[model samples]
Target: MTETTPYDADRARFTRQAPARLVLCDHAVDVADGAAGLVATEHDPDARPGGRVSQAVQLLELTERALVSAVIYERERGSSWAEITQYLGIGPAEAEKRFAAKLAGWDTAFDVPYRLDDTGRKRIPQLPTAAYDPAWACTQLDRWAGNRLILVDNEHPVSSGLVMAVPKT
Candidate 1:
């Protein structure tokens, strides 16, 4: 038998409220503030070198990087790998390899389709997903409604993912 975790319970609760619209949003401000707080706490002489603050800072950095990747993917939705690589300052293979997972998550979060019509021709739309919008993200955060659920890792002060929750309203 598998042991049940709190996360699993939360997910179950979230799923039971399914058929509800889920919205994903970026955690830009939360990540920034958390990073700043970590830096501040770390600056204290009494604080240990590898304490919660240090760990939080690392997580915040990762979240920031993920957010950056999401932004780039949104900005260059239809661009080729070569183009994305150039913009990201990484080689084609590296770019794809590094961002593939994150991009997949983003794609799912945004409910982006495989193709869109452009000029009467099928083409990929750049940032077709509204989840990347900072304003939308903020609104969701404020409302706390819908399938959008913010995942806040205890280790980090800010959220990691803006998961959609079942809309109560």
Candidate 2:
């Protein structure tokens, strides 16, 4: 017999009540780039080498989420599974099996938007927090990258040349 967690129960009970929002490729790339910048460099003294392993593990998780966001963005833009699978070094069938659930959740979030918490008062977005509020994600990620990665033009925003994918209102 399988044990069902509270999370599973709550997920099943969610209701769709809002318009769908688009998750953009540029924002997802920014998230990955900003996270990569967080990896400590040899010249950075503030980083404690003792905790490097744990920090790297955390960054790995962040990178994986960013990749998921990128895939979702690509799928929304009409990219074929074959094209995406080429980059992952996996067959299309396996790639679809791995990501289909996440892609479904992304689609569902635009319809449901949020669900009530245990208290039945709070609204928790079904979408990943970064994808749910892309403007904030862009601002925070831009700040993170700008602080760590040096650019030739200080005036240029880290997200320059990237177009935001906003849903038509």
Candidate 3:
């Protein structure tokens, strides 16, 4: 008989959570809501007819960003090109060709974590904010999963078992 450890339990929970694509889509919806809120506050409903079109265009950018992030997250989690391609309805080579540059950049960020800004004062992180600070990402994602997923234990973070190098603060 095998006994399951707490880590195993958490890993199981993490695996049960939605795939990266669905999670990213949920995030895109949240971003769209926020953008809509900003547009609503900044102008009247009838102020500009073209504003709606522009907002829709802007949301496309958010979707693109989310896609890239989802790819990065899945890759980091040890997902194979074949596995990812199945969801995208593309060949593994095509998927790799499309995302290779972004994956290279993500890998390179670890070598040089930050760069000086134009002012040569403030430091800007090269990695995506979530990648740069995985502990925080884990916390946030876990909380979101606990709230959104059914039968998840709120006390245990779903992503706690993920292997991430947390930067020392």
Candidate 4:
């Protein structure tokens, strides 16, 4: 009798090379199931509550930072205001109003290439554009970074796409 290894070398290699984070946000039921499984398997009620609280708080803080970073990174990467607005689930003006304070100190120096019409009127929307604010961006970036997971909405362009923005140290 021969014994075979369970690991698939090809799949492991592909995963190792992929640069982006694979966030499975689509299918709320699947996410909930996964979360439930994790919670059930990873946590023990007998464990000290203090430790759990501390870990939760730390995770929250990290998530906030990752959210902000991801927003800024996405802006830098040339995402559109419309896209941003959609992601934020807010009107352009409202989103800007909410995040103005945190963005005040940051420079909107980054340029994004976008074609306005079929003729190709390339223009760069101002950094921290109305759609995204520094504070909110920071919060989102932190959230994404902390989660180390991606949530994919069926409506999003990249259905089942992964999005992870780890701040380069």
Clash pairs for candidate 3: none
Better of 2 and 4 by lDDT: 2
Comparing 1 and 3 on TM-score, the stronger one: 3
Better candidate number, 2 or 3, judged by TM-score: 2
- Order of the predicted models by TM-score, top scorer first: 2, 3, 1, 4
Tens-place lDDT digits, model 1, residues 1-169 = 1333223333333321121112222344345456656656455777676676576867767686655554454434356777656656778888777777766655464344234455635545233223333334334444442233356333322122333455555
Candidate 2 lDDT over residue span 93-143, tens digit each? 998999999989887766565777899767777766555555454465566
lDDT for position 21 in model 4: 19
Name model 1 segments beyond 4 Å from true.
1-25, 39-46, 52-72, 109-136, 140-169
Q: Estimate each model's TM-score.
A: 0.40, 0.62, 0.61, 0.34
In model 3, the Cα lDDT at residue 60 comes to 77
Weakest ten-residue segment in model 3 by summed lDDT: 1-10
Q: Candidate 3 on 111-139: residue-level lDDT in tens?
A: 56567789966667775554444445566
- Please give the RMSD to the true structure for each candidate, in Å: 14.9, 9.0, 9.6, 17.7
- Cα deviation in Å at residue 123, candidate 1? 32
**Best-matching candidate per TM-score:** 2
Model 4, span 1-169: residue lDDT tens: 1222222222133221111111111122233434444355356666675765665565565555445544444454466556667888888778667656544433332212122455644343333221222223334444443455355333332312333334336
Give lDDT: candidate 3, residue 130. Answer: 46
Q: Output the lDDT of residue 23, model 3.
A: 42
Q: Which segments of candidate 2 are over 4 A away from where they belong?
A: 1-51, 152-169
lDDT of 4: 0.39
Using lDDT as the measure, what is the rank order of every candidate, best first? 3, 2, 1, 4
